[model samples]
Target: MEKIISHAISERVEFVLIAGDIYDKEDQSIKAQVQFYKEMKRLEEARIDVFLIHGNHDFLEQERDRLELPKNVHTFSSDVSCVPWQSPTGTKIHFYGFSYDKRHIRENRLGDYRKHGDADFHIALLHGSEETKASEHDVYAPFGLKEMKQKGFDYWALGHIHKREILSSQPGIYYPGNIQGRSKKETGAKGGTIVELSEMGATFSFFETAPVMWEKKQIVLEGKADRTEIYRATDELFQTYRDTLCSYVIDLEIVTEQASKFDADEWLQLFEEMRTESPFVWINTLRFIEKNQAVSDKWYQGQFLADELDASLAELMEDETFF
Candidate 1:
């Protein structure tokens, strides 16, 4: 947030838009609210406008006590509405969005968003997932891609998905993604998009704001390679990140046909030893995968004892007398 505020001030952006999920939890702590307020206050002092909405994670609760935001901040209400703002260069812009009133919003609200007014640019903010049964994410305000494209908004600033993606380029539908990664699974350069819009179309670039990044790298070894060779490759991998400015929490996956030769305890000790060498890199996890097999025979014997016991139990049950 500090980086974002600094960037906004430095770039002299007319306004800032936070799609949703400002708070991690619905019942946000006072400390978080105070911290956020301080950041918002900084933007307010710089005379930058902030427009934000609530997502499922931080859905609005009318009964709950809420901290009053700064004067510069404009929050969207439960009902879909369009707020107009004149850009620094005198380009009329209309921002259309709505805040989540409850945790679950099963209804598709995309139809509610319609480009209106004589504004030069129309930007819509939506915190929802693409309507698909295969999606692992919770379906809230589900929308179809075709439905969104047909809306004819100049740009769609989306939220809810932690991974940054440009669903469409022509109309500039984007998911800036979460600025900070909360888990190891959410990897890559985590940040928001700086969109440059015009009467022609929209062009945007992603900026890295995450102080610490989560990354996963896989090291593939030949069947003939020994432990010494494997360790050397791992060391080489860490050396590549020596010039990284921000700290990284990396998960390493070692793939080899000679999985039996690799020892977890030795790798764990090696990780601990190398962790102190670089202040910027911390190896959070180490996993081994067999070359062509799903699970290595040695992995089951050494790591997954529960699976082995289950197999043993199944064998005993074949005797008929073994309950």
Candidate 2:
């Protein structure tokens, strides 16, 4: 976060926009608040403004302010609100946002946003996941992508979806994702979005901010591929890119057919060897995948039970080491 703020300061960005979910918990400790403010104060000193909306997990209580913020930090109200900011270059930007008052918001808050300013660029800061007709997900501000697209906002900066995704490009709708990944489930490139606005509109791109990366790499070999080849390839690939990744736990699953020479002991040994050489590489799982190719075979069509037994024994026989 300090590095990110320093980067913004060096770039002399007009303003910083945080859609929501500043903290993992709403009852953030004083130390955490101090650390967060310490970074924000730097931007405040640099004459750069910041706009933030508190997400469901980071809502303010009815109690008096829990943390004090600098003059430059402007947070949106619990109700939908808009703030018009005039850039140093005399460009007007209308920013619409709202902080979550509760942990779960079932209502579609998009209707609450009333576009009021004649600013050159109009943008919305939303913190919710897109809802589908058949989706079983918790309805947090239930809304559809199509409705959001037709809302007339020039750009939509979204949050709540921890994985970065761009729903649209023309009138940009983006989820910057969480800056830091907390778990293995949240893997891959974790970072924030950088939006550059002009007469053409907002051009958005994602930049890596997490010091450590969380990634899942799946490695599958062909039916006739050598076991040694798999070990060598996995070793070389990790060794080649290990330095670039701060830390990673790769979940590896192997898929093979009758031609495969399988060895659980050998694979486990290789995993150990890699960990000894590169401690950052943690192999989570080694799975054997069974494809439906056997069931589709003409020879196995009418003999389901017989074919199942043969296929299972074939796989076992291929892995047998004892005489």
How badly does each model clash, as a count of residue pairs?
0, 0
By how many angstroms RMSD does model 2 differ from the true structure? Answer: 9.2
lDDT score for residue 321 of model 1 = 19
State residue 280's C-alpha deviation in candidate 1, in Å. 2.6
TM-score of each: 0.85, 0.78
Candidate 2 Cα outliers beyond 4 Å, as residue runs: 135-138, 221-230, 256-273, 276-279, 288-323
Off by over 4 Å in 1: 133-138, 277-279, 292-323
Residue-level lDDT of model 1, residues 1-323, one tens digit each, is 88888888989888888999999887799999999999999999998999888998899998989889999999999999999999678889899999999887878899799888898888999998877654433347889999898998998889887879889877888888899888886788987678888667778887889988999888888766787888799889888888887889888888887676678667878777777443578878887777876354445555557676766565444321121
Q: On a 0 to 1 TM-score scale, where does candidate 1 land against the true structure?
A: 0.85
Evaluated against the true structure, the overall lDDT of model 1 is 0.83
Clashing pairs in 2: none
- lDDT per residue for candidate 2 within 49-147, as digits (tens), equals 999998877876788467789989999988888898898999898999888888778778889877785988888888887875534444567678888
Q: How many backbone clashes does candidate 1 have?
A: 0
